[model samples]
Target chain A: MMNRKILLHSRPQGLPTEDTFKFEEAPIQEPEEGQVLVKSIYLSVDPYMRGRMNDSKSYVPPYPLGEVITGGVVGEVIESRSDQFSKGDKVLGMLGWQLYNVADADKLQQVDENIAPLSAYLSVIGMTGLTAYFGLMDIGRPKAGETVVVSGAAGAVGSIVGQIAKIQGAHVVGIAGSDEKTDWLTKELGFDAAINYKTTPNMKEALEKACPNGVDIYFDNVGGDISDAVMTQLNDYARIPLCGAISSYNQEEGSDVGPRILTKLIKTRSMIKGFVLGDYADRLPEGAKMLGQWLAEGKLRYEETILEGFDRVPEAFLELFQGTNIGKMLVKVESTE
Target chain B: MMNRKILLHSRPQGLPTEDTFKFEEAPIQEPEEGQVLVKSIYLSVDPYMRGRMNDSKSYVPPYPLGEVITGGVVGEVIESRSDQFSKGDKVLGMLGWQLYNVADADKLQQVDENIAPLSAYLSVIGMTGLTAYFGLMDIGRPKAGETVVVSGAAGAVGSIVGQIAKIQGAHVVGIAGSDEKTDWLTKELGFDAAINYKTTPNMKEALEKACPNGVDIYFDNVGGDISDAVMTQLNDYARIPLCGAISSYNQEEGSDVGPRILTKLIKTRSMIKGFVLGDYADRLPEGAKMLGQWLAEGKLRYEETILEGFDRVPEAFLELFQGTNIGKMLVKVESTE
Candidate 1:
């Protein structure tokens, strides 16, 4: 059978265009010893992947040109050469933008479809969930009645973060790019307040009015003007968990020089911490159990915007920068049926 | 008796000039109930006092226009009406910029002239030393053999910070504006290396050479381009204790927008914590005992740049911006003998 894959054609200086990616077809390779041939069901497209596109120093290495762009993928184990996995078993692993992949058996996590849908493994119970769990609970450490502001509040990681902060009894305020996203955050996700940053003429004033008691913890996903506004209202000993700076991910390097917000940190005796999900790899099991329990109890809610067909993967990724996705952005690599 | 006081004549638009302060003489009042008549001996001229000069919100309130500017002062009690203090007792308290004043006895800390010098009460064993100890130990949290960088390394708080980091078993690197200060840091204070930021053609390169191992802890007393340089060399999980930002203290309020260094912080998974010594007031005795023991064991060294007269207090305060002092800067308000 033929396998279709997408490759990085060239690195973009700023916002990636249609020409930045290339699609090609090849014959599917057979699984070797201790490996499994998997058919991709769902592929995740996230903002963090933008960092790996740059040929510079970052937490993750740059994606090599002329190779299949890799990310979180949920697939069905159609052919297995190992004793650990059986045919027809659904699994989750870091695969690629391809219709099928030959993955190492050890690297794939078996997904129990009866427990939850296969796409849940790519989101709320996976990387995004664990990130929100550790960063907010550990770094943000929001206390009861304290105001917690989450930027990119309607996005995957932030939507979960606001809910978790609410679970911890914090007064959750969210900042999203659109009114619809903000409404969803407040109405559906249980956020106490949500600001449409795009519609607001004065963000600082809007933030001040929303967080009347001042912000105690800031879960920053978009780190430009929104962060600057949040910073102006931080109370003494406030904590800022720097998860992502999606605002500048597509901009040319050095184009965005944010205001000198560090002074506010000094004045208020606050703390700003930058962290990634991989840092808490050891605690993933515990985090997954807690998140799973929360989901099972209906205490958490999630949404996914899935694009149909394998060829739409690049378009789904581009939509992330456009603020077009309501929640987790995913590409359906193949039909489950 | 007569009292000669320094008053805040006008609020400084940018940097304080001769017009910013006014000297006047007033009648010395009697010590009523629960009060003492004190003769100021040594008054501290600290960088933090600059914040108090502006009519803005801060940890300390702004110096009232047409009123005496107040700060940490060590003095001798000439008269007392309270049981807590007696006549001729040496005391340390937050007194005004005056030669003689009536201060509340309960607010004064009795200083023992026999243990260390009276000026030490305003410095090494007092505010400056405590600031260094807590900010470095609690916030910086340098582990053994890790590289620690202290900016404004020649000044009051920065000098003590570098020494404390060394005592904590870290490889200390000092960044000072002058070569003389750098020499003092490396040659006398036992610093592993010192950078003369002024003469260094490329500060980032110089820092890289000085700290071969990436900086694990940064004791930031000066924030500006110097701090920007230090940030680039931070190791993963690096900790920065934000103390003072002397570089921009004198600049026009809106002119100094520091580079968005927070991005580097995210990339490194580092933390920057801003704190004041008052936060650790309850733990002062423990910190003082350790500092005193270190000083007695000759493990700690200190320097004091004492300006001779009370009238030189403003000049001494201005010298902080000029980077003149080698260590603790103080104004001798009255002679001890």
Candidate 2:
């Protein structure tokens, strides 16, 4: 069977273009002992993928040229050499930008289709959801009646963070790039207030108005002026959970260092914490169980901005840096049916 | 008796000048019910005093013009109308910048002269020492064998922080302004290494060489490029206890923003926490007990850069901004004997 894969042709300097990714076809490899051969269904295109494209010091090593671009995915097991999975068993694993992959059975998490859609496994019920859940609850530590301001509010992790904060009885304020995203946040996602950062004349003033009591917890997703503005209004003992910095990811080389709010931290007596999901690997199951329960009860809602076709993965990934997606940006590689 | 006090004449634009202060003399009024008259012996000159001088918002309100400058002080109770204290008792309280203060007796802590010295109440056994102790142990959370780096290393809070980290079995590295301070930190304070940032051409490289293993806990006293440099070399999950930002206190007017290290924070997955001593007021006795025992056992040591005479208080405070003081800066208001 033909196995289609998108490979990194060269490192991206800023915003990745279609030329940076090369799609190739090959025969699907057979699964070895203790491995499963799977056909990719939904491929997650996250902002963190930008870090992997560059050869630099980071939490994890960057993707090298001439290799298939790697990422998280939900897939259907086509062949299984181990007793852990059957041919039709659905699973979630790191399958990269590929239509098919040979993954170790140990690395793949078996998905229960009866509980939620397979696509939910790639967004709300997966790493994206867990990242938002743990970061807000653990680091942000939003208490009931406290104000929580989240940037990139329409994105995967941020949307969930706002909803989770709301469920926990916090006053949730969201900062999004567009009016439609802002509406979606307040009208659909149950956010208390939403600010269209692109249209807002003064984000600082808007944030002050939105959070009259002052922000007690800030779930920072876009780390630029919006984050800076939110930081200024934070109350004493405020918690800032650094989930992502998508705003500064695609800046041109030699761009001036963005606004610093560390001095503000001292005055406001706030705490800014940067965290990774892998760092909390030990607590993933606990996070998953809680998130699963929330999703099952319909208390948590999520939306997927899906890009059609496997060849569009690079474009879909680029949209994240440009703030073009409404929610979890996902690319549909192949039909499960 | 004539009561002498320093009044805030004008708000400081940058570095405070003599014009910002005005000396006033008034009659020492009789202590009212539930009040005691304290004759100031030692007045504490701290970095946070800079924040209190500005009209802008901060953790604490600014010292209003025409009002006595607020500060912590060790004083002798010359008269008391309350049952809390008797005549000739040594006490510590927020007495402002005054030769004599009619304060509520309940606010004062009876000082034990047997424990080291009376000045120790404002140094190693006082709020400064407690700040370093709790900030390091609770927020910084340095693990054994880890490298702990402290900025303003030879100063009041930083000096105690280094010694406490050393006592906790961590390799301590200190960053100071002068070679003499560096020598004192390494030779006298038992720090593993000390870097005089003035002589060190590359702070990142110096820290890398000293730490070998990236910094685990950074007790930040100076917030500027020094903090930025240390932040770049921090390990994953590194804890930074934000205490004071002395470096920016003397910046020229309109030069407000400091270095932007949010990106670095996200990259390293680190945490920066700002804490007020009042937040841990309940735990002060616990910290004091531990620090007191450490002092008695000679496990912790402290140095005071005493600027003699109450008239020299403004100059002594200004010297802190210039990085002139080696340790806790204090002004002798009156002789204890």
The candidate that wins on lDDT is 1
Instruction: Assess every candidate by TM-score.
Output: 0.96, 0.97
- DockQ values, each candidate: 0.64, 0.59
lDDT (tens digit, per residue) of candidate 2 on A237-313: 89998988877676542253644556678787889999888878999999999999998899998999988888778
Candidate 1 DockQ vs. native: 0.64
lDDT of 1: 0.89
DockQ, Cα level, model 2: 0.59
- The DockQ-based CAPRI class assigned to model 1 is medium
Distance (Å) between predicted and true CA of B218, model 1?
A: 1.6
lDDT (0 to 1) per candidate: 0.89, 0.88
lDDT of 1 by residue, A73-146 (tens): 99999999998899999999999889999999999999998988888898899888889999998899988999
